[model samples]
Target: MEVRASPREYDGTFVTTQFGAENVKRAARDEYRKLIDKHDSEDVLVLTGAPTSTDAFRDTLDEVLPGATTPYVTSPVVHATDVLNQTDDRVVLSDALRRELRHRFLADYEWETEYLRQASEQPSFIEDLDRVMDTISWQNISPEETPELREITAALDAFHNWLAEHDHIERGQLIPEALDVLTGDDYNDIVDINAVLAVEFEEFFPLDRAYLDALTGDCDLVCIAEDDASVRRTWVETGAITDYVSFSESRRASGVQPSTRPAATAAYFAEETVVDDPNTGSVSVLAADSGDNQLATIANEIEELIEQEGWGYDDIAVATKQSGSTVTETIESFERSGIPTESATITGFGDDPAIRELLAVARHLAADDDNEVPDHGLELDTDRLARVGEMDQLEDAIRWWATDSGVKERIAERETSLDARSQFGNVRRAFRMAAFLDDTAFLDATWESFEEMLERAHEYASQQNQTSATDLDGGVRVDHLQAIKNTSFKTVFLINLTDSEYPGDPFLTRLFPTERVASMPDYPGVTDLSNTDVDQTFPTDSTASSRPFVQYHAEHARRCLAIGAEAATERLYCCLYEYEDTALEERAQASRFLTAAYADLPWVTDAADPKITSEQAAEEFLLSRVDNALADVRRANSQDVTISLDEVEAELGEIQELLDKSGVRGEELRKALRARVEFANGEVRR
Candidate 1:
């Protein structure tokens, strides 16, 4: 049993905690402590991150007898193989270990869990999966294996169905037999499982990837590495590094990073390392690179800001333009820097520390207060929430009361009897169904209720369609920059502000006539060129007002610049990267808003100075465009190849525009256009 508890206790109950790297260590330590207390020390071993491993070893030396030391290890490689060897050689050699290995294999591609569950729900698809798994199975198992396999399959299928119906499902719903059903044979089909599972799950799985790559390449992906023994390792998570690093890596490795990386550039850590020079009391030269460092670096500067300039954490915000990877990095970096942070739309609950923390609390409370369930229907009087004491306890109580089947059934009866507006009734009923997992007795009860006031909250959260602003004790907020637009940040790192990044094309469901120009009613029409050709020959009327690139750029630029203006009291920091470019024009255009706002205010660069030259900037820009074009080819191919003649014409027009811009209508551009046309036509013909 893991004695995972928070360090901070609020009024005898631990406040809701954020499950983090530190929390993992603490949990491991407590588990070891419990083992000793139970005098089961020989069977207990601890595994933690490298840093934690060293600390745990030092702390345990005083208590553990010499040479009787329980193993303390870091790195999954050492822990998994070694621990299995020591704990159960028979257990490891048995089919059970093989099954465990299969489960681990499934876990690698578990992004398809939703897909797998959905497919399992489909009797036909489930049959297909069964067949697939059977194809890999070698029949050397005990007579009990068949029944056990069927039982495990049934449980997995049922679990997925339950999760689909409910916004969130409780853990422990997956029983041990579920693992018992899976074996080494099933491991062989994990990749095929992902592919087939994706299609059956929804058009969203494959179609979203197809469309997202069309709009931008920021969708989820998996990579598999095969070894000499025919063993394969798969990695599927994203955003371990900052956007600039990811982008640079993409460019260097693949000519372009998948656009699905979600075009984020800057990140904020919880550190207080300000860009101000103590000697001059003015902007520091290091401010340029200052904005580019991870949250840890930012946190250090922020501390300095407080010490030197009397700034508080509340006076600052750690922000980035894109949400997915950049957001994750920012949160992780903040944790490392000892600054609390949250994100607007965190994906998969597994990756989100906050949601996991909430779940952990809920589980603990449910277990501790199992006797509290009333046979009679419970009506939540927010006022009575405090009677439960510690806010965290109340939250668990509320969540259980709200989400439990018995509780929901009772609430349905009450709602049927009450006279209320249908919309509010529906909304309130939704809470009864989903349950408020956050503590409701605290001042936060009203707020917590809203968390599940609508069933769609889960969907919105899943799709990252909603923007949430979080206040983490201090003035720190990880919010939608758009939400707090016009508000000033003490030091803002305006990331992903690249030309194609900030106002990056949103998902467009409609396809208009290729001839139609993108223009407002008040503006002269300009052909909506898809990066290929532009018919500048459209009759120009001086009287017809037109939307210029300058205007569109300016609006975003103003938003970017206003962030700086709002931080009048504090040093403003804007961090951007120019990939593969070495030209002044490209560099100048890269931070166009900063360049435009150059004269009115003081601007500075960081000492970890990036050599942004005119030539380099241009090269990066050109390469990015070229890379995008090739990527477009791959993405377009993934979709039905039917190329519309209008689309072909549009491509030609985009090419013409590029030629005009370059002032070099070389044979290469012409050849590329021809190749695109050929590919499109080939697809259409097929």
Candidate 2:
């Protein structure tokens, strides 16, 4: 094997190099420049492991090869899918179709519907099924012995056969199918390239390896990797790429020195203060009373950063493991603080009040035999209706009731109004599904089918990115660990860093048992793979393995901070509610990573005192006055009498005094209070 090594300077040629994080960008720029200089910039294809990496590569390329056209850069899955889609012999099924198939499969089973629903909603369910179909030997298993497994296998087989019969394909089938296409004469033009560059990817799946093999046979292969000899050797052995060049010395020569501390700690604390320079950067770990308190702490810290450090909202990023209720509460807190932030994670639209209410109405209407409305406290016009009367009229009726009963108006007042509207669209979709099944036995059998359909509707909605009102130019970029990779920020707050939530619980595919999946020959074992590269296989039961990748993400900022509650008081309360009459106890621990990182540093233990901004105070004062005015008007209307103006004046005077105390005075406060009072009076009359 011939190996070509480059110095610290660009030599106008591409090479397989192992570099550190600091030098990865410079190496990519050099490689990109060489490729563009040698071949047309249009002919170069840059394959990265992540979308974030792809963006970073393009940015670096623009800097290095200025005035040149940007080359095609994409993740392997995306590139493969694009190639496979070029032919019309097969049709690719959308996510919506895959969801429908899963729904149909679950409907055939007789187990707990909740378990079935949860299994269907697993992020990797479809992908895991595809993997099984491509690798597992189904003939060896028996349906009688493992009924759930049998049903899963059969459903998968049926789906594959259906795709074959209909000349259709799913997203997971794209990579393998494209690899097969690449080996054929038809795709020669597509596969022929100047060079193939794989960056920041630790391991390759079988499909990924196959694609790389095809690419390597056609063109030059250069992998910009970390200092992992085993991974490099695996690529050479499995992918059949020959050359290896060490850029470590050059990277170090280029003034990119590794920190003396553990990479995990350096990344987690991501601050110059760790190097004994407090004036240069800031880092802190906060312990809060609850998740809400954690978010309040984050909001306070962000405000302080903006005020003291002269940092813009755009200069901050928040990373978390999951978009659960904590995320929702965090967004609400940020909104309350009047801080604009953009969530880069997909939030569940099922959490939207409008969607929940719509589904509740549908359920009530579908239960024709038991014609009783569930009391949700809100006076909905739909609740007053005796029945839907007609299946076709359900959607319109629901919409009418929602509009007339002020559900939409109430939703409009929420910060998540945009998301609610999207969920409402999903609700309409469920109704359409119901309308389509009206003539079938499914709709007539039981109301549970409609509920299942609504659940499916929610699942689909949850897969989409929720709306966050943000300015186009800048706002705080709030996202998960994965999304924030390859991006830098001045200040970063990694929230929900509890033991189970930070690195997150190790993912085990529900389609197969963990032990069996790990034992499979082709399955990427936990031992050798990086967390990001640990493809559908179960991860190792070690925090060391899991926490490193998260730490890497944390280190992407100049100043990284984290917050975790020491004990979950909220979970204890939930336990109390669950075991109403029985004795129950629950306890929680903060993430071990947090404890380790902050053991030697000063820890901030206080829950941020909820700051009442002048805007908030003024709004509250006006609302209090409006509530009093509304109460007086309602009382007067009920008694068939008029309230004295003096009582109203007194309430207004109290509000004015409160606003004055909060430093909200002059014409602005007066106009706000007057508008609120007028609005309240009009609402009362209506």
Candidate 3:
């Protein structure tokens, strides 16, 4: 990027920034001089072609070393493009491509009420029933004596009955419906099913079918019966059955399973061995603890590096496997620590208003030319934008993208095909062509439109809703993965890095054909088994005993490891909990080479520090700051002529009251009083 003239004699050095090139011509000359043994100033050749790295190379040599020879080569070719023709060679979509992909993500939305209505009429209605069971052992309290308690009890009974009767019902659908019914009518005595549904609505209710099905189908309800005999009797009477059964009296029955509970919630902490002076330096582990408390340790280290080593916050990064909770916690903690961290932390959210607005403008420009809105036309007005910033209007724009027709149209034009396209043929070609050869004018127009839109959004947010709190920089930007990567940190704690998550499930990933039968050993012909008086399950084809060449798990692991490794730095930390740890470890190993070669940092395992919280330290720190501020104020006030003795006395009384309330009274109070007196005396003299 740098350009300057070179010295008379060809040398590797250029007269600019340490790594800067003289002029393009001089750089070319220098390159040639380095390439050739001796450079004749009069015998230089010049070449030029498309505006690329090649052009820069040629121009640099021609200008710097005048006699340098260069050959101009042109074959009507642009920059080299890596065409992903083979399926194996293809890379996952980039964020931009992903955003485009999202538009094509067939939105098959099914409402809860509607789905229930349609499914209610199906055969095997009771198949959906959870179970019907009545416990004979009841509290001796009379229903008349405790009506409210009785009502609640009765409601639970009714709920249990409904569950048993409708055992065939989708638990996912039934649970929501049951909750809705419970919360709706107090007549039943339990919190209405409808009301309970409302409480957990967002958790189960999803925007897409995949989300809904995944939530519903993947989990099973675990019922623990206090009396198994009673449960079986009730189920038999109600025509309800279970997939499995156990009773204490039966020979097949097993006793209650032993609890596998660790002595402490923090078993890892318990396993830690503390070291003294020689190993006083902090230990580095996988940071497997995903909780906020664990992240606090990592954040504390970063803070230590900043304060002790004098490194900027930007110099260190906090990377997590995915842009999720750990990232959010770390960034929020950083800001809470009074550090002005930038919009780089990959908290699972969206982008900064400034950047988002720019991107919106860019995306708009990248799409089409004719749909320019007034908002997109204006040049960026910093002051006006600042006022908008004050109001925190980015939320409005995000909301618009989520809902508004115009914005949706712009997005759709840039991304989705105007036809019901399959993953083949003309659609793919159209997408590629549109992406590569997008109209320049349209892109410019879109940008201008977005700018104008942002201004309007800001104005509305600020002027109309001043009283209401809008986003004022608390939440972290999460829109783009690259942006997320840019803001990621050193200690990355990835959760849910399981087979069902990373490569996703077979159904979701659609990696293999849905109709493909799961490969299993096929039994061989055993016509002579009678003669041997035995049955054989061996397959005729020995090769059939081996699994088909399906490499789903290995493939998924490779991809996941590749991504994690690519994102990790020298001090990378991969954290997963016991629930997910085994699978994650099996799936991928910690990134190889660096940390092991350099040094080993213990992961500071320990008994959970007796919860003598840093909260207490934080409180003391805050009080100290307040005291310092008070000292400065008193010193200034004593020298000022703006107040009377009455004002001084009032301020003193207030300070004393505050001190008493805070329990920081005594010597500190005396010192403050003396300082105030000295300040007053100085003021009087002045």
Candidate 4:
């Protein structure tokens, strides 16, 4: 038997060749501790490409170096921009500002004013403008020659000049300037460090590569390598790293047993008996009809797991491939099922009701004409102010509206209902700041400039209000796959495993396609560009891309559970008839991993057939009506609210006739009738 050796610091850097995520974390922790003890100094800096990994590194540091003040830990971008204070008086332009600049440029130069105006309302279009800027920047070509580019460049320059006049620097200039600062003679004065630990980073941009190269000359460089050999090979080919030794062996820590890997096909069965054993853990897969159905089914399963298996909500986790409405839906469904759930990712402020409301007000005000209402004391009709075009009159109308419309009160109500009220507070602050700016900096501003200011306020609010999922208290953790990395759970439900969803296509921006940008000579840092081509199939020895990485991490849990939706359905009704047609449904093929793992397993057929008999259709309609009526009555009763007696009587009358025709006589009939009467009476009384 070949004995594996533990990772140790050789020369200065320690590289671990562990196969599992937990093993790599343990190895890094052990080596980090040794280095701290050996140096007898705490001037250690830990850097990673991701904020999530930074958090994991900090956790390990807390455990290994207890009582020691937490070391300076941060992502490369944050450390360079914030901790190092590499930026000067120049302020980084917010994404919103960039979009506004692009819009103005397009309107003035490209003759795309109408398109630009319409695009401004779409968040995705705004995002594409950022991509356009990236492509232009990456090519290192001035936009002066290209007419359209000239306009964009002009707008950007204008924004930059405005910032400079205000003694602020653009954020886009941070990286290049920071690189210059670090590569200069005074770099040592800014960053005083004894050792640098880079963990779980698979790629490096040119700037980061340069930064790391400079650091290695003065201090030890320890990097944990768990990415595919090809990824590392590409990094080497790109001159991101010099020759370094590696310790490729499994080093199991004492008392830490490897988690059991269940049969891949275990999850494809309908019975829990096939998936789980009493003594051993198992992996299971769930199927549903649509996204809504998927969430509902998962909620039901979680509720059952908590009750039947006596598992605490904390012991389970729910992860999705994407974040957005799906996350909101999952949380809502879980809450509906009485399962306390919290997200482990920051939701964007774009969806915040308060922010939307504020944007609406801003748009309405900006679109106002010059017509003003006659002053009528404090009772001046605020609605008429929307037609006032003059800046001073609009300002007065805004002030009056702010005071009279109870905007603050409405914001407070929204804040009270939000789980992360701080986010709403930030939005409220931004709205106030915008209002203040309208009276000050933008007093005589053009519509475009005013819009830009609003965008700036929104950007500031979003940055301040961004909430971390880690801060949430105990509940069933609902997070993206990335956030759940390095964390363990007793059971994990990995949903949205369809081919189109899992190992999702790389985000192709307008200018720099992910692949080309990643391969660019002076690209900033490593991205998932190379990993985009990772095979989206079952895991094998040759599989080394993101899809398998996610799968491996998911399978690391004690029990791995996955859910996929087979089809999406729409219900249609013609007059008094209603039916669900599979022909009209859009279906998703099962993930390759699912199909491969359960090729022999029978596909779970839907219980409902496409064609419905007349009797079946009538029965379905009647059942739905009955269910809705009962639910309404129960809700009204619970809230001590009254319902219309006539409506209740009509529903109860139909139910009673059905029972009578079914020949439910004697004490059973009497008891059923009595229960219905009591239920109706209780609702009416309430």
Candidate 5:
């Protein structure tokens, strides 16, 4: 567990008990101590809904156990393989490796398979098939309704079997497979656990609940959640959960009125009005001209939070609904502003110099084409690589080549690069891909196919949405909205709130119609199809069939907003940009969610007039003051009026002294008084 992912740093000098989330953690800690006291550490299991929560829970364990051993702690979505590994013989694949294998299975998928033959005709057949595999498979579709379902199921069966044959398994199969092993008579030999605790029960799926239920009978079971109804309905009646405790009021940052800010911001998302007190200084909004402008403005605000409010860099976090490219851009922008940020966004790993170097060598040794096979911009290792020729194993051959070529060692030396953790992770991830390839695939793998596999791995891996930020090293975090769900910060910036991006339209699955999937009550992605508060509903008309899915996404977007709002103990900034700074220079509209939020949020960033607080601001203010005074003096001389200078002379002397320090008036104004300027890197402006 990465205990410092969000760094649990609150800005104000408040007592910890008043903090709402702190109290929540305290309650959880007491519960953990209770469990550990009664059961041995190995006999207990603690489950979290997300990686961030897992990290937070780990932090609590450190406080309670304090250098003592902690019980098994995990977020199943991330640690499923770790939990399910029953033996050393099988190869467990993360999403990236699984996708590479899936593509391999499909490429050689017998031409006779009905679904493959039909799907092969389409240009996006692979993409379509990948999406089909990604569907949660909670709904049971009968081929009687559509024969395509039968063929798809067969394809899936064969795929799973192939993975098993290779002594491998995809991640989703880990929990269910583990259940089979644990339920057997010899289960004690595999896993010996007597108690289980699942937190954030509201986010658990039906399958997760099933796994929790299977753990009952001999073991004590408990679940911590913000809501109680679902847990009671599923587990309490089923007798899996024997008791429930509700922390009715969650207090946050116990200085002044605790939890006031988090609760007030949460009210807007709940569609409730918040009575404002200007002194509350909790929720605010900022709109900018473009993407770069928005980040630059945010960078400045973050500086204000640090320099003026005494907020530490660790107290701040900036999250976005959009990731991948947006996250990469945030890293670039923050680096330029001299703000250190910690993020686990490894989406750019495929293109990094080190990973690319490794891939190039693999392709050069395997691929026949000889044009510009990269060699670290050094002389040829071709003689050695060519002499090495082909080895029995794909992974070993690559390792052998790399060992002799010194690529991994070179990448190990790439320490000065920021986000080096991710770079190294990617390097390992890239090598992980090699293990999936056999001698056949390695020798015959075209340069294009190799690159394509890397790309496919990245695309599939991103869907897991694993933005697991690293430890609390006193750097502000830039992560996805989902990554920060259960982690609290002193200030939270929920950015990229424009319609073109936020609450984005859902995509249609390849194999099934939206109507079919949405009609199932067991759809695990959303809560209560008929839930009216967030307007989730199934439409009566056939033409409006996709409404339920769309509503699911819209509701999810609002839920993310609420999580962000609740995560901040003191300040929250809902940020957006009017344009994306593209070649077309198109304008963007505010999201419906943001518009609705603005109706209740009174504090808005003043674009026209903002308060000046820095030394540069003072210089610009004073320059303007003296220029206007000189104008007034000239006007009075023309009108032949005697202007009193006795009092003004002393002030003029002081202004002149400051102006001399600020340099020449023109240069000073350009340096300090420039307006409409969101960002500048030395002389370069955007």
Candidate 6:
């Protein structure tokens, strides 16, 4: 990741960049730090596209490069906005705090962001404002859309006025103001940026690149894209990289390093190529009857790898293609099957027990009616939140309340469990929020506002602003396919590879149609021509009426599938199901991508071939034995059948004892065994 031999004579700074979700940036940051350290160099700054936070990134930097010349890490907007703010030193409200304040102001002034709904179906107006503001595209609207565009522009102005009333600035003003500073007579960073090397620049918009280019005129402005498995120093000016190199025939992963070479279509082909035994186990297609069957199979397979091959739980991963409830269900499925899973995807703060417990007390404090927190059916350690009687500060109040309620103690006591680590992460966020509330602006903040901020924080935390796979430390990783980018595992189970999910439906906004949205003028990603076509991609029927939209998502799915395949270093399971109660149509089929890639993929699908781990060998043996015994008992009255009653009793006893160890085993199997026992007592039924 070293700066390509900069022509600039000055060795100014190490400015490393990464592009992805917040988790990706954090993960890449650690990886980059290790790489830089290995090269005997250290970064002086960290730039990410996340406008939501700098404190968390700073916290990340402190944990890694602590006590060293810590890099000045923040979003690109903050980096420039702060530079412009150097003149007047205006207070910048974080995106999180600003959002809550906007709602409060809206409620107090009887103001409605209803116009936002008129423009976009999602009424997620703040994001709409951010989009136009970040790209400065509000000024470049068509004549037909002027009325609606004007409404959005006016809303932006009103927001700015409100922000000014509180003597605060938002990130929306950062780029424009910073640009003004850059275009003007002088800027300090312009001179300081003797060289600017941006590594793996994943999300540089035109405005962002312009601002950076303005800051570092002719300095070493090299952006190395490291997002793709096959990406080399591919130079992209817009920073939004999409054209990752496709699988090279020679570069294809084998039984050693696994990779998902996407198929041309979802069709299976007969090839003369013979699959080797070891290679069969390396990459395979696993199918099941239902979700329960699939998860049980996955758990069994994971256990097989651990017990038979000495693979640690951490080496395995279950990267789901779906999100939200599906991911949650998968986690619960693994838990029920006694598999420990560290979810890299956020389940949100609403589900966190620790956060809810603390907030229940906060709600009580705000009402000033009770000192006791209702556990909401939770098995908490205490009934009453004791006031420490030392300070009335909210942060201190929360600390003592948690201490009294034993929430903090319980969190601290947990060390090894995925649930424990996950709860600890939430508790840490709560404390961070508490510290943020202790700020000057929030001195008069209400409990309603505090809870609102926590809601948004945790919601964002769940969305994408969270940890990478490495942060999970231990346990089998369960995350979405996209979240596992730039990561590797020894054995990966890419489940939910079905038609409904693999080439997922395109996310078209209610505000705009997806007819060349990526190619339109002022299209934000117009310069990233990598997404301009889908000639090689096979379109899905998800949006069959809209070929353009379907193609767009189809290409996306192909790329994502490739990413999933590349994550596994040794074994990769492209699993699907025959029936899922949660399926869109109640009957699931294998992903076309799997079939299209079948000929090129390494697949050995024999259930009893010792290669497929999707079925438990021990369970199969027990079931087969029970089936043969039942067949003989059914014919006990016949001359051909030999009913060995004593031997059968001993065998049934052993199986029964084993079943007892497994929580009474399968009821169906128990019923079959009982039927054979009944035949011995002269009672017979078909």
TM-score of each: 0.30, 0.59, 0.27, 0.60, 0.71, 0.64
Which run of 10 residues does model 3 get worst, by summed lDDT?
195-204
Q: Give the C-alpha lDDT of model 2.
A: 0.49
- After the best TM-score superposition of candidate 2, give how far the Cα of residue 230 lies from its true spot, in angstroms: 13
Q: Which predicted model would earn the best lDDT?
A: 5
* Predicted candidate 3 versus true structure: per-residue lDDT over 1-686, tens digit per residue: 01112211211111111111112223334334543434243322221211112332434334544444443311111101111111112232322222222222212212134433454354422122111101110111123322322433343354334433533221212223333333343324431111000000111111111122222221111111111111112211111112122222211112321111110111111111122223222223433333433444444545555565565554454434333344455556655544434333231122122334444443444344537433554364444433433432343433333243243334455432311111122223222323322322222223333444333323222111111111123222211122221122332223333334433322211111223312211101011112111101111111111222222222222223322322222233333322323534443323221122113224333222222234323343334444555556676779763435565457657656666675554446556556655665565423
For model 1 the TM-score comes to 0.30
lDDT of 5 by residue, 531-606 (tens): 3412312111112224544655554556566666767877888888888789998888887777765665565433
- CA lDDT, candidate 5, residue 262: 55
In order of listing, the candidates' clash counts read 53, 0, 73, 12, 7, 2
Question: Which rank order by lDDT, best down to worst?
Answer: 5, 6, 2, 4, 1, 3
Q: Model 6: what TM-score?
A: 0.64
lDDT by candidate, in order shown: 0.32, 0.49, 0.29, 0.48, 0.57, 0.53
RMSD of each: 29.9, 12.5, 28.0, 12.5, 10.4, 9.9
Q: Least lDDT summed over 10 consecutive residues: which range in candidate 2?
A: 567-576
Candidate 1 ranges beyond 4 A from true positions: 1-296, 322-328, 342-354, 357-433, 436-475, 486-489, 496-554, 578-589, 598-686
Candidate 4 ranges beyond 4 A from true positions: 1-14, 40-42, 83-87, 101-126, 132-173, 229-280, 303-317, 323-348, 367-418, 428-479, 489-491, 503-583, 598-686
Query: Top model by TM-score, which number?
Result: 5
Error of 4 at 380 (Å): 13
Q: Residue by residue across 1-686, what tens digits does model 2's lDDT show?
A: 11223312212223333323445666677766766777776677888755445665666667765565666777776777777767546765544444554456444444333544567567666545543443322112223333455555566566667667756676656676777877887666666576776665443444464576575564555566543212212321222122222222232214243332222233333322223322323344455545554555566666766876687777776665544444555555676767776554443345556667766766666564654655555444543555443434444555565666677566567644444454455455555655544533323433555555666656554343222211122566665554554555666666755655444443435465655543333332231234433211111222444443233222221121211110111100000011112234234466555555556443222233435433444355466667778788798989888888788888777766766776535557777667776776575423
Model 5 scores a C-alpha lDDT of: 0.57
Candidate 3's C-alpha runs over 4 A off are 1-283, 286-290, 323-572, 576-686
Candidate 3: Cα lDDT at 25? 27
Q: What is the Cα-based TM-score of model 3?
A: 0.27
lDDT of 1 at 578: 44
How does residue 608 of candidate 1 score in lDDT? 49
328 Cα displacement, candidate 2 (Å): 5.2
